[model samples]
Target chain A: MKTENNRAWFLVLPVFALVAFSAIVPLMTVVNYSVQDIFGPDDRVFVGAEWYREILQDDRLQQGLLRQFVFSFAILLIEIPLGIAVALAMPRRGRLASLTLVVLALPLLIPWNVVGTIWQIFGRADIGLGGVLVTALGVDYNYAANPFDAWATVLVMDVWHWTSLVALLCFSGLKAIPDAYYQAAKIDGASAWAVFRFVQLPKLKNVLLIAVLLRFMDSFMIYSEPFVLTGGGPGNSTTFLSQTLARLAVGQFDLGPAAAFSLIYFLIILLFCWLFYTTMMQLGRGSQQ
Target chain B: MARIELAHLAHSYLGKPAEEGDYALRPTSHVWEDGVAYALLGPSGCGKTTLLNIMSGLLRPTSGRVLFDGRDVTDLPTEDRNIAQVFQFPVVYDTMSVFDNLAFPLRNRKTPEAEIRSRIEEVAEILDLASCLRQRAGTLASDARQKISMGRGLVRTDVSAILFDEPLTVIDPHLKNSLRRKLGEVHRESRLTLIYVTHDQTEALTFADRVVVMHEGEIVQADTPQALFERPAHTFVGHFVGSPGMNFLSCEVDGGCAVVDGRRIRLADDTAMDGAKQGDRWELGVRPMFLELVFERPTEGVPVRITHVEDLGSSKIVTATTGGGNLKVRVGGEEEIRDGSAWVVFPPEQSLLYRNSRLCGKSAAGQP
Candidate 1:
């Protein structure tokens, strides 16, 4: 057998240079800022680990981090299983199947900021449709003044906008399965629940893992939607870590503290994502053996 | 095991039976004896699979009852019918070990742990998969996965019947022969009712004890392999049951002789025309293997023009045109003939006569 060889690295050199210039340079700048104390633009002092210490001691950052964890966990709990169920209900072949897919994918195509803005108006207690309906139903429906109402509105909006992504992924996974599997399940005398548990669920593991990780990362770093909808208002009840970081860096121009917070945020996401990826990959390998 | 019966079963995918052609499967009645191996043989779109599905309770017949052991099960679900089915393609859980795949049905029924292990071992050994018991089923080759699927069906000994729907179609030709032989051995050892469905006549004839020939949504004949070949109950059966099939030639019956395009072929007995009138559209059917090729001029033989000759190692299939229609004759080795100049004869006793597509009785001299 002849082994073919070619030089393809030359073509990718420019992309590598561009990524390093944009990503590495900025990341180093953040690291530099994170450990320094700047009295002004011209005078700066090297204060190693001082900002890190401040960040750790700050109670507000801790609250933001806790809220971020809870929000991401809650989103995952609601989306993954619901997506699988919807995908199972979808038709397998023909025009109806494609049409259902297109419909499910519509919400995902909407820009994240636009999604937040739309829900902001839609959830208004005094003028919007959601507010009018809730008020007419003889209930107190004030999202502007109530922290619980604001959080609930943000969570529901995120579910509505993103659950379809998980569903679409799961739908494709389910479609890839041949009809022979179901036929065998039938002949094996499997109950409906058993079929889903043994055949369908195990098959969907890869897709579900992807859905979980994507939704978790997105929810953890959520800023645009809640920012537009509630402005992290009602006394920081809806203020997540991303929103808090933005408030410090862009809102108050505390670049040093914000850069420190950003590193923590990045590490947290990287940690969780790594955990999710390794766990799923191990599961996939285990099944193959 | 239970004797399966289909009573006047007919099916149509259309909501209303608008015309005679609307039915996908025409009404017919047949009985399958318990513990007997049967094959439903037909071409594509012949409703053989549909009938098998109906029998397995996967598809309810549009009309009529399906009885098992004299009890109507037409409305029963597949799980309640106690049937194990192997499909055209392999279907096994990728995450499960081969042992688990074989033990799945037993586990579903809550079979004891020790029994599950023993049964799984038994089935795996039978399928030559004992060494791969702990490996995941999905990582194996397609043929191995198919064996796992077969084992899953065979592992359960309590099922009333095992249904195989073209299970060997996806297997390699060499592996198919071995798997088929293994299936025969397993069938003999277990004596479970087996219903094999296939479009390939070779597989059907070699694997089945009683072959059911189906055509155009109806069964034309059901009998042992020898009976189907020697005494076909319908013209379709004769054409569908043999390799190269039966050669059909158009003919007309006069007083005591059947006339082809222009030549009069002698009949062994005049009673072949007992119920036939003159000028009736008739066809004479003969198997290629039964038609003897003559080297010298012989009396009472039809003249033919040899068109093509295909030689197998032990025999030669000679294709010839006679009376404006084509016929195939299988001659033994060492008999040589030149294409376009060879002549042949059809043994009168082995010929079958047909009228309006149904078998008019056998030739009066009888089929040998």
Candidate 2:
């Protein structure tokens, strides 16, 4: 039964090389920048952990981190259940089923920048459809002036754009369920809610986990849509880690702090992603036992 | 338990049924007695599963009514049918423990927790899934998962009937036999109205009290297993219900006899051949087990050229060419016979005559 192990490494070598080239090299560069101070094009100085201390102490970074967490959390909370519900509503067969899926995927296909631009114009109080409708309905809606309005608009846009991915994943999971399960449920006299709770929800766990992690990471690293829409403004209300990193790197021309911030941002995303992955894996294993 | 009666049940996937060909399940009427096991037996696309689904209320029949205990439930949804169904593939909740999967229906009905526990345990015990109760269903082996699916159907005691749609297809051969026997035992002990749907003749014959043979959306015959074997109402039933299937030879009726390949074979009853005329196309059907090899030509026997011989454990199958087609003869013991010279004695009594693919009558007597 023993087999040769010579080919085992061959399969993984390419992936390893790719990851090293794309991720590791840049990560090392960021780490190098974080530990030093860049004075100018040709000048530099060693400053051990100074940028870390500065980032850790700055209230703006803390606020941006908190805002990023809230945004990711809120997106996950809204999208996961809503996506599943939409998936459940989708037809399992026929022409309409595919048509509905294509329609749901349309928002995800739009470029992120375009999505932000479209939402920015669409939510305007004067000429935008959303703003005009809201104003006509007697509600004061202004994304440019109010921080809460800006945040709400950004969150809504994110939900509208990204919930489709979750729904599509859930739809595939739902479609993969053999008709036998539903028949068994019916034979068991299961109520509609019972079937959903016991059969559909449980079956959709893996897909839902993927959806949750993807949405959370994307929302946490959100930069383009909010940047193009609100420019992180009215205040730092819509400012996420990515936007903050970009401002530090591009607007202020502080490469050292910006690199440090980028590394911190990468680590935070990596940390949360690991947490999500581990939690999902543990839940999966626990259920299997 | 409830007796199911199908009153002219017919279904058509097409919106409008302009003709008989449009129906997926043709209008049929039959009654399945409470506490009796029945199998809807047919080949693929024969509408057997469709009938089972209709009976389970998974699909509503376009025409006619379904009655449970004489109560009309034609318009009822599957959830309202009070029937348990085990589908072809295993369908356990992948994320739930086997225990929870088995307890789902009971919990849905708000059954007591203690009752649910005992029922799940009992069903799992019957299905040999007692050791895997805590394991997630998706983690189990395919056969074990299938057992859990069956257990889910069996856990509920208040169901009016249990419908099985080829439930043992994924199980190992040994397990298939044992489960079939177990199902038969369960049916006897509980007196549950069970409708099993399968294309496998052995499973249908061994597990069900009665077999309803279907062909192309029509029920050809519905009778006890013994009757279905002894007197198949249609030629399709005779051909479909046997292991090797009945060997058919096209013939023409000639004066109270059927002449095949220019050889005359007497019919069992002259009255049964009243409508048969010369030159009319007919078929002579006979089971392989009934055909006897004769060393010398008998007074009234058709000649056959032996083509091949198969050594089965308990019996030997002899393949012969008669009338330009292959026919098989099942014989017990080691009978030495040359391939090209062996001839078969078609005992007139053991043969069946068919007109227009419908069995006219059985022939008089032959080797059993």
Candidate 3:
């Protein structure tokens, strides 16, 4: 005969209830709304796979996705190398290091919407410092009237706001390396470029992976900053995926299609994150072998 | 190989050292000849690692001149000094293979590709790392990584000296002895000036041709292993070199004899007593190996109460108390020692007198 003690499961009941109430219930409601069309409180009709088909066929959603991909890719390319360079140039010890760390962390602590509002006013051609300085160089710069200007402004704003996070992560990674490695490298007669390539870069792999994945996900699902800054742009030039989903759900009240779009957006982020993680890990392993 | 000389070397980490205690290495002068293995042995915080780093050019002494083959290279960087140092913990490039790791130094000097490959092969064979030449250095066991660290030092042929800072500290106990023996063989084959720093006496005595014993940030003695064992220059050396070390007892000098607790123990015949005034302080120093425990009390033996006996397979260390002083005697393992009163005998030839921690006369048992 087997004696079983079931009281141990009681310890896990609260966590299970919390997750079900917070996550599962809302997810199931979204699934329900995705498959049915509701015209009124009491009148509804069941529609299987119609909204998914329609959202996939829509040209506006496709364009929004392309814009989102370009923005994320551009952000990653500009921030990672710049962040590493900044981290390398920063001082490694004493009062100057502490002061630099506090200054680097300042931008990350500001509210997301506040960051957008600051950049929105900061980019005005008439009164803002950024605009007056750029216009003084005698190049036509008007973000509110030109689409290209608006896109460039938004990309630059995002880089300025988020690059410090990447730099801070890289700084911590660089600090963890032992001084013995540099000493050994000096004795081995390695050049500065060799030390950076073989020693510094290899040691920073794990932190760089984290920085890439986080920046990718956050930029893909970005809503508040762009909403407050350009309001999806001067002429839909910077209209990304989250703005499109918000317009479909709340602006037009297209509940079924909006629900379908949300699911697709979540899945896309998940797929890309998996791809980034696996490819980088495979590269690391390949080097090891 | 080159003859390395340090002239008036002293180091202080502080910007302005006010007193003698602020200096890590006090002012000293020494010369290390070419093609000899020397070990710097000292306790923790005795400036052993500091001296090693200074010699390797990883650190610049506050005031000193380091000469290599009669040329001053004190201001040279580590790479320009033509010296290789293996750190206390193994340092290996995680991204590189063992073959690449060994070829790094040679490639930096712009050696031909063929020569680099041949040198790596030779070093790998000598270090028994030939089978794992293609393996990633990061994935190997600790001992293997340490061997690769040693191999990197040996791969470079242009280096005038190779320094090791407690290189085998991270290896397993069973492998430490074998690695130590391999280092001795490598030193003999390469004939390069090798300086190793370690606190383990067995490793120092076994691996180096001459050992420099350090105490309180200063080198007290530099001699062969047998000489260090038989004739220590200072009390610190006599206490530091041997297992259970040399036993010291406070004694009152009475002409040519020393009185310990109202019992007279004769000092060596050569011990100088003519210069000694009345009420002079002296100590009798004797090694445990020379002290014997006799079952029957002899006229010259002092009675002792055996407190403990430690069986060490080949020998037994008999610890006893006599006249308010502790005496440890090493005897054969099979030698039976009773727990009650026993007599301890200190050989007259093996015993010497120390005045203010300095040897009073030449050692009679071992040739100086």
Candidate 4:
């Protein structure tokens, strides 16, 4: 027979109550606003999902959602593999390894708005070093007036700023693998690619899952860098879901539909995160059998 | 299938090693006959792993040539050495099934698919891993995983040799015996050259026919396990090979006798007699199991006061003292041993003489 330990629940009551007070209250208020037509603080009418229906049908918000998905997908495609390659190439021990780790962490330490501002000035066609070099190389390189160029600049800026976070996470993952695995792989006569596929990759699953979650959430909800850099671009080509939500809520002063749009945006991130987590967990379970 | 000859092999971790003390493995030339089982036995940090790694092609010797079947292979990497090695810690590709884990080396070597199937199944069966062939390798208990580590080696028929570096270090005591016996069976059935490295004397003596004892980065003695037990060439071997170890007593030279603990121990031959009379000093070596303890005051034995008798289930270890120190004597449990005065007899056949920590006297059990 097992003894009961229900007394431990009292110790966890504070954290649970704190989460309810801080998160649940604000979230319920957002839910309340999402369903009603708000004229003032006390003057409200029960619209019953009208804002949800209207927000979902709006072409501008739909375009923003599509652009948001593509941007996040491109970020995952470019950063994950490049980060792993950089981590693998870095030294694994001694003074050089420490120096490399410190260097890799530098880009991640820069605040988002500062990174956006630096890239903004750096992309000017006249005085910016990068823009002048590209212009000298004989290409149309104006980011402020061209939608395609603004999109490219924002993508490049995000890659430059955030790829190191993935690399640092992966470097720690690689360090966790013991030397015996490499020795056994050598004794097994495995090729270089085979070692990565069978040994290193399998050992890095947990870290990769964490990296994917963090990067996915960060990129899907991204706003500050693009807001500071492109400001939704020349034609709305770079207007992502968060920028569209900000336009409705703060810029245009449309509160009800904006609340409904923000809730839908939160749900999209939640759904994708659940899918990624379940898929990874299922892969882990499949390997155990 | 192939003889291994290590020609003047030496290794040093330092760049430009200037002295003999810098070497991890001192310079030595040795040969391992084909299809013979040998164990390199030593305490930790005694160059056992260094020598094994050199032979396995994992580490290059600082100065030497390694020849397999008279073909020079000192420059080859571990992949081309065609030798199998099981590590101290077991390694298995987690996502792979036990069958695939066994087939990995075979597939890398480009063996025929038909051959791979039969070979993996056969090796897996031999390792008693047939039931879990389809299960993931990482899902098994450690002993099973260790068996998979060895099975990967067994699946390859073209390997010149198989090396095990303390393969049973992580195994439970009850299972260690079965694994060792299985290894012995595998060696007999396959007739493959096996070089096992270990620090445990019992494991070395029981697993291999020939035990190579190393001390301080050099091979001090390489001989039959029986010979190692009967007559150890170095004092370290004498102290390390047996439980409670062999006893040593300093001797004073006298006419035709070496007096130790105020008693005369007969000299074996004139070679030992010359050393007893002229050498700086001589010491008599005898195993506790070989030292007979008599109950009475015998005229022909060394006098000792019986301090204690330890009754181990099957045998009794009698501790006696004569010259300000203890002397251990092992006798059968049925043997009558009481407290107080006793006599210890050293047979000329079993008593060996050592000078400078090395065997100097000619004993009956000297190497043939």
Candidate 5:
């Protein structure tokens, strides 16, 4: 006969309880609300997948999804390479490196709504330095009236606000590489480009994966910055998934469809994050052969 | 092939070196012949790696010039100097395949694809890496990675010299000898100037045609292995070269005779003691292998009290005490000796004399 001692499980009971109270209960409530139609606080009717079907067919949700995809993709395309370039150009050592690092991290520490408000005033053609400069160059740039200008202003604002996070990640990755690799590269007569391609790029793969994933998720669920700056802008042109979800759940008070929409939004983010992680990891491993 | 020369080479890691101790390498000059294998032998922190790095153009000497085949290349970059160095730890491009790692230099020079393939195959076969040509370099064992690093150097035929900076430091003890011999064979076939730096006397003796012994950032002596064993130029070399090294005893010289413990020993016929100078420091050195032990007392032999006998499989080491200091003697086979009394005799030809730690032009004597 074998005797098993399970006393170790008591140590993990607190963590399980914390998760149940904080996350599981609230998520279950959302799930419950997704399958019911509430006419009043007490008069609720059961609906089976009707709100899900309505959400899947809504044209506004489709447009919002398209906008979300474009915003996330554009952010990744601009920020990843620009951040790597910034990291590479950074001073490797000395007092100047720390000083530059502190400056680069300043924008990241600002609150999200403050960032949007700052950009909102900064993009006004009447006052801000950037706007003044653009006007001095004789360009018609009104972010309020033109949809294209509004989109451009929001894109530039995000780039300025979040590129430092990616840059800091890449900087640490670059620092992790040993000096022997550079010495060996010099002995091998590797050109600058070849050294970057073969040595630096391969070593940065994991950190770049993290940066991309973070940027993608954050940009896809973006709500606060654009909400304060453009308020879904000029004719819903900049309206993304999170903003649309907020409008349905808070402004319209359509409980069933809003809950169902939130679940779909959650699933979309989960699926994309999974796809990004697996594809990047597979690429890293497949190169071993 | 290149005949490398170091002219008044000196280096200081400090920006402004003030004292003698500030410099890592003191002023020195040496010429390594074309296609000859040499080794820089020293203990740790003895400037052996510093000299090798200077030769490979990885470092610039604070004062002096490096010449390759009569061309001054002191300021040349490493790749332009056409030198390859295998470091203490193997440095392989982790993401590249074994084949690509071996072909990197040739590819950098824009060699044709067919030539690159052939060269990679040749080096891979020589290093016994043909079976792992397609395997990723980072996945190999440490020894295999070191071999790949060495193979990268060997694949470039146009190289003027190949430098090894303690390349076998990370290799297993069982594999060290065979890999050393492989490097030796590679040097022979390529006929390139090969300079190996190591602290191990066995590796220095086995791999190099001539060994340069360094101490305290200066070259003490550069000679053939046999000559280095028979005649060490400095007291440090005498104490550093052989197994158990040479035993040194302080002595006084007067009127062509050496005296230890108030007993006079005759100097050899060709030994010189030009001046009967008094109060000069002198030492007599004799290898442990040259000392003979006799059970019975002789007319003119130093009597010793035996302390211990260590059995080392094929040979035994006898530790004894003389009036002046302790002495170790290497004896063959399992000699039966008790820890009581013994007589030891030194052969005249095998004994050397030193003045102020430098080898003097003289020899000590034994009883006729």
Candidate 6:
């Protein structure tokens, strides 16, 4: 038998300390705050699961949660495919590739609030070029006056600002594939579509997973762009979960319900992430040795 | 199967090459015999792959034409070339099953589904991929994946030729032989023209009846294995095709003698002192197997000082310093060398003469 050694355990101690300070401690404080009614630091009373029950029963938050899911799924459906298409259409190499990359990265360089403000004016239907052009094109386009318009404006704004992330991720992934694959495909008499479906799509699995998860989380917790562009306005049509949580904790100062709501929200996101990761990993496991 | 003629073929990655050095493949004209297996042997960046690629239509040569059975296919795309190539690294559709991977080319060519199935079964059995037919190709080990890649080429019954560019490079050392044997068996059964490219002399010599030796983007010599062994057209072939390869010693030719380091060694009585012998460069080439070592001084041979001995089980290779150079002599297992100073004999019949890096007078015997 080999001799046992516990020395390796100490090497991981720093990581544990880091997680405790960064996540575990903060999460525990939130948990502590959620279970107690804190009128002030000195005045407090344990309320059991009352905050959780109240938060779950909240009508506005329920609508916000539903809206959040719709928004997340909507953005994912549009961005992932659009990003892949953009990446596919982009030049493979040379000066044009550099120019396209810089142009695509321009959206990501703008701050979230600035993107929101830019669109807010751009969707005005009065002085803004975008709004004026659309109105002149005979479409009734006004983000401030209609709930559907506000929602559409927010979705469009998010796509414009963030689709580049997925595209760039996929671009780098596509570049990493060896030239031999394409040559082999050519020799095999594979059509253009067949090459994409078999060689490129399978190779892009891991990158697409990362892109999807990042897009899901970001879109689910979306707040700044929609807030600046629509102000959760036109009858709360664009108010997502993050906005609801913010209003609870800061706007109404209902920290107890907000903490409980956020804990539930965090668990939901974690659950979906786990679901996506496991399903993707298990897709080809059946045929593997 | 069809004969492939590469007529005045040349390629340079540059749009317009200004010099010979710019070419990846120097202008070459060669005709591959139908149903004959050939190996293209060369060092790295020697344009063997470029030539193979040109044949398979993966690359378009800057000049010349490729004729398959007298049909000009120089401008054809790879799909239209009706050829297949197995790459150095394994290339398999990650999501495809072994059966599907094998049937991919057939499917692309619109072969009947039933025909594809039967063809795959035959190739799968040949490659021993029958057991893994239902398994995902990407999940298999590298050897299995490579087999799948090769099976794709084998499934095509109508291919004019099949090209392999260092196909066994990624296989496990123990598995390379098994795969090579499987490939050889397939080639014999299919009898399609095979152009196997490799830097390994053993792989080329053992696999191909005809071995084409290349150097620096040019075909140095194309002949049978025995011809390459006995009479290499160029010195590069002499140095590239043997186990230890042929050894060369610089010398000057005068009448029927080769003067080496101020010592006169008699050449074969039939040595031709005509045009080929009058070149500025002269060297004598001989394989280790042809050189003999004797303790007593021989009147016909030169003297050498023994420096190193390597025992290779069945034979011993003795490195000797002679004529301002070193030569290796292969000795049989039972032979014993008793002297550090011995007379190294170059057998007249087996010895080769090279002038300007080519076989002098068409052969060692000085026949025109």
- Candidate whose lDDT is highest: 6
lDDT of every predicted structure (CA atoms):
0.85, 0.85, 0.87, 0.87, 0.86, 0.88
Query: For this target, which candidate reaches the highest DockQ against the unseen true structure?
Result: 6
Clashing pairs in model 3, backbone N/Cα/C closer than 3 A: none
Give the Å shift of residue B186 in candidate 6.
2.0
Q: Mind sharing the TM-score for model 5? A: 0.93
* TM-scores of chain A across candidates: 0.92, 0.93, 0.95, 0.96, 0.96, 0.96
Interface RMSDs of the predictions, in order, are 1.9, 2.0, 1.7, 1.6, 1.8, 1.8
* Residue pair clashes in candidate 2: B349-B364, B349-B365
Instruction: Count clashes in each candidate, considering only residues at least 3 apart in sequence or on different chains.
Output: 0, 2, 0, 0, 0, 0
Candidate 3 local lDDT, B1-368, one digit each (tens): 89999899888999999898998998867888999999999999999888878888889998988899999988999989999999888888878899999888888889999999999888888788999999888789888998888888989887889999899989999888887888888899889889999999998999999998877778778889987888777788889999989888888777778777787877666554556766666788889999978889788877889999999999999999988389889999888778999888878887778777766654523322
lDDT of 6 by residue, B109-201 (tens): 999999999999999998889999999988899889988988898899898999999999988887888878877888888898888999999
Off by over 4 Å in 4: A287-289, B14-22, B253-256, B273-281, B363-368
CA RMSD of all predictions: 3.6, 3.3, 2.8, 2.3, 3.5, 2.2
Tens-digit lDDT track of model 2 for B1-368: 88889999999989988999999999899888988899889999989888889988888899999999999999988877788888898887777888988888788778999999988877877888898899888788999988988887888888889888888889999889989888888888888988899998888898888898999999888887887776677788888888778888888777778888888888666654656655655788888998888768677777888878888878888889888378889888577766675567776666777777877743322111
lDDT of 4: 0.87
The reply for model 2, stretches above 4 Å from the true place, is A1-21, A40-42, A91-99, A287-289, B17-22, B277-280, B323-326, B339-343, B362-368
TM-score pick, better of 1 and 3 = 3
Q: State which docking tier applies to candidate 2.
A: medium
Worst 10 residues of 4 chain A by lDDT: A280-289
Please list all clashing residue pairs in model 6, or write none if there are none: none
* Better candidate number, 1 or 5, judged by DockQ: 1
Candidate 6 chain B worst ten-residue window by lDDT: B359-368
- Candidate 1 structure quality by residue, lDDT tens digits, A75-115: 88888878888999999888999899899989999998899
Better of 2 and 4 by TM-score: 4
**Residue by residue across A89-145, what tens digits does model 5's lDDT show?**
999999999999999999999999999999888888999777778778998987878
Assess the local accuracy of residue B342 in candidate 1 as a C-alpha lDDT between 0 and 100: 49
